[model samples]
Target: MSGPGTAGAVETEPASARAGLGGRYARLWTASTLSAVGDGMSLTAAPLLAYTLTDDPRLVAGVTTALTLPYVLFGLPAGVLVDRVDLLRAMRGIDLFRGLLLLTLAVAVALDRGNLLVLYICFFLIGTCETFFRNASQVIVPSVVPRKLLVDANGRLLAAQTAGNEFVGPLLGSVLFAIAAAVPFGIDAASFLLSALLLSSLLGVRSAKPSTRRTGGPSTSERPADLPAAPGSGVDSAGPVSATRPGLLADMTTGARWLLRDRLLRGLALAAGGINLVLTAGLAVMVVHAHTVLGLGSIGYGLLLACQAVGAVFAARLAPRLVRRLGDEQALVCVAATMAAANVAVWLVPVGTGVGLALAAAACAGVTWDVVVVALRQTRIPRPLQGRVNSVYRLVAWGAMPVGAALGGLLSTAFGTPSVFAAGAVLMTMIAACLAEGARRRWISDPR
Candidate 1:
């Protein structure tokens, strides 16, 4: 099955139709990278600050929990909102809102007023906006690029994201945090403001408007008065829903029903959820692990993260080719197996260099998995349902992060830091087995 807007068209288009990702994609890519860098800085700084306030592993991990909790709480509603609104406008507004929030946090920190409560509130709000922002971004990509180039486009985007989010951003953030503890948040605030300015230029290229034609069958009236009007029609395109429009509950049900009826997507979401639950568990206590077992400070920890980012960039560069050769189903299985092995290696080799190498391998597997799954999801989902379905899909895929982080904190508090990696290896091995069995049973399809 192909996306209603892209896949069918890709099948008929000539080889000559292959073109560069174009100017619009470039702008979106830049804006997304800028935002990712800011997010990375904030993420690195937040945990470091938490570590300063308290030595409790659970408290440190709570920062991560706050940053991901909103996905589980509001993923469905965010999907509905993303589907109903103009994506560019929504993203611009979200960037500005998040910038203001970070600015406030920066001031709070500068004034020596930072506390665990304040940090949690700030992270939770940022995470809330992230749910909508990430969904809207994914929904807009297919509109900007050809479906046949989905793998290439997604791989480049993932690479840029890794460089900014993990490589440059975290390294810069840790250095700044060591200076004053407030500089990183201030810098992140500025990045968001700049990103919003970049997005303001793409409003006229193509309006990411939802399909106004009602589902169920063809109809003479494709444009409904209750739906948002197309861009530049001299109407408020993303105004509040009219009473005649489908209610929020109805919209949510539509997306959920579509996802549930698709066996491959449903199974993928469940497997991803399980994998994330364990992966996040290991990551949540990484700060504690670095301090207690590895004897590393902030700079060393940032370098450790940089190792993973470098591996991710390398893998993202190769993901498109790998997918083309191995096919999507096989590539996914390979990623799962690789990740399981990497986690076990970390458990076995607890030294700084050995663990960093293992982490790099895990990051490589992670980016490969992301590029394949995101492209598959984008190409397979319908255009109008992109936001809703992607959100519903990620509701399981990403919503497990906070829960896993919390579990990690509890386990670390009881069993010690090294145990987190050992436990993650076991869980990931189980995920790999399930994925292999699912492939054999034909629950997953190759999107070649």
Candidate 2:
């Protein structure tokens, strides 16, 4: 059952209706899982190729940065596009485009003609596609599944993401790359094709739109109950009367303004972005640590990544129960504190044993934040603004990734890899402290 005072269709879903998560949501889940496999393989293979192509840690990290920079560049624009288009068409088209790009990239890699510039272009284009794809995935959920299941559904999506992209995808990619440099990417491309086909078949499909309110001059009255709620926003999901289309500039900032004005969302966005910065930094900086400090090979490195992913998989499965038992804020404190301590232990404990265990523990605990926050956002944000709001939130949250990646390179260059990981651990701990205080003060609340 949903929590009391829940205001959406998700709140009123009967037990019988709850079963739709497995049936309808299963299609999306499967589509996401297949897509994640492609993402996982490409993610592991790209970095590996970069490492082989150049010995410079910064260049390798630059590859990571290239993939994430699109969010900083095109996130808001893509969000605006998503708000006004068919959700499946947007996702399906991106998958097709990505597949073609990957296949072409695979050909280049196979011919040994691929260079750093070429790689940067491919990663950037693909990353840009992903920004919309990611947003669409979140936006489409409510149209398919009831709100009561949002937490579980999102958790399941993350678990599949962890399993495919992080664990299974990377593991297979390592093996495939050993046989042929282009094989993993080729497979990834094919996976996208398959993902597109799957998305093509979804029932009850809805075009992605901002949950807009109609305006007559300024001073509009309260929203009528018949409009479609904003996509992905849980707050206005109950009725279907959509909001009026505002100016393009106004539409773009609508989500951003909503995010900034809300205290809970503001706090959560900060916490999310802060952690992304540190984690992205870790991705770049820690690869050096894995190689130099831990003495890990490419295969070993893939396995090490899998360890964190495996823990995240478990966390995705468990987060819903934890949130219900502890409430969102308490769950975040416990999970964040555990992850912080685990990150510190990554450096503190003996290199080989501690590194693996610490990463696993930290990853497991860390996913609680994503599961909780995603569910919270799904329920609370108004549907008309979901896409734009998510984009702006990501603008702040995910925008930090590129900075972290670049900074990781610079920091590792200047302070050394160990210091980078240590710094990340410290920052994570501090973020946790701030979140704990905010939760204690009840800064995060229903704002939609």
Candidate 3:
């Protein structure tokens, strides 16, 4: 999971390794896309599977709740592990583990032995692995591709992720599920295996420095891509030389403090969290909503969601241009408003044309938002703290999903899915207003 130009592998690398970078980057991109496809398949299959097992809104939400809960629990620890572990080895191993688990689940389902309890356990484990894989994936990118091609490479990867996970995966998963419930998971398992195989091709990507914590080397940056660096420390040939590494709690706190210390970073984190809170609320129950409110079959529901991915593809191409045109703050507001609009459409119009278009708009703007945010963070965060700070930022943003999942279930139970959508729309609008105000005051300034 090493990504482009953040922190992982030292800034300097040999030209020989950088030669034929495209092929190497393509392999990593394929790995990422394949894994994303599996994730998308699960997003559709897992909740739908839960619904098949039970009719309770709360219980169905529990599936999503279980999947996301680990981000809050294991995120920082996983970040610590990523810094210490070999990126390719860790990614390949995790993929194998996930693939085996899914293959087992597929077999169980085929045998009619699958149960909700088993689903919960499998999902939790998969989510835990994903926590590590995702973080590492980002860190490993810069190591594989040069900085000049970094943005283009990431954009391509993101596009592939969107296409596989959202466009192809959901539609394909729904079709497979219709043919046979075990089929989607079977494909997901295969996808992971393929991804693992692809990881072996990354011969050039290496840790900037092997982490001393695990390698018995000198201190360095604690990123999956590099060794742990002390606060204000410079990169070293032997390893990072500054203060000695702190305990886990203190190390994690240091990363968190760095992010919170900056007003813009703090605002961005809060905004992302708010966005996730409402977004998860809708997505958690979207399958059910599509069934009851929109009166759509699984195929129709899949297609409806696919529109978002289609729009995202376009967004991926244009995000950099849009950010340059609008600047960061205005662009952030656009992202928030677009999401709000999508939820509003869901609340107001249950039909395909309206909801699909709105969702697509949301997806489009959301990606632009993502591109801007990630690019900004890459510029701002020091390479040494990239792993830790990225984890902390995600810990705040993604932590909202579990809470939103639970709240979504509660809201749907109390007032139905439309109400939840309506509430999300309102919440997002308020968030957009706040961001706009901040922008007007020049609070959310560009890090560069």
- The regions of model 1 sitting more than 4 angstroms off are 1-27, 140-157, 201-245, 320-330, 375-384, 445-448
Report every candidate's CA lDDT: 0.73, 0.71, 0.75
lDDT, candidate 2, 125-224, per-residue tens: 8888887777667667766766677766665565566567777777888778777879988998988888778878873454443333442111112222
TM-score of every prediction relative to native: 0.81, 0.82, 0.87
Which stretches of candidate 2 lie above 4 Å from their native place?
1-29, 141-158, 201-228, 231-244, 317-327, 378-380, 439-448
TM-score for candidate 3, please give it.
0.87
Among the numbered candidates, top lDDT falls to 3
Clashes of 3: 27
User: Candidates sorted by lDDT, descending order?
Assistant: 3, 1, 2
Clashing pairs in 1: none
Which candidate leads in TM-score?
3
Which one wins by lDDT: 1 or 2? 1
Model 2 lDDT-worst window of ten: 1-10
If candidate 2 were superposed on the true structure by all CA atoms, what would the RMSD be?
A: 6.6
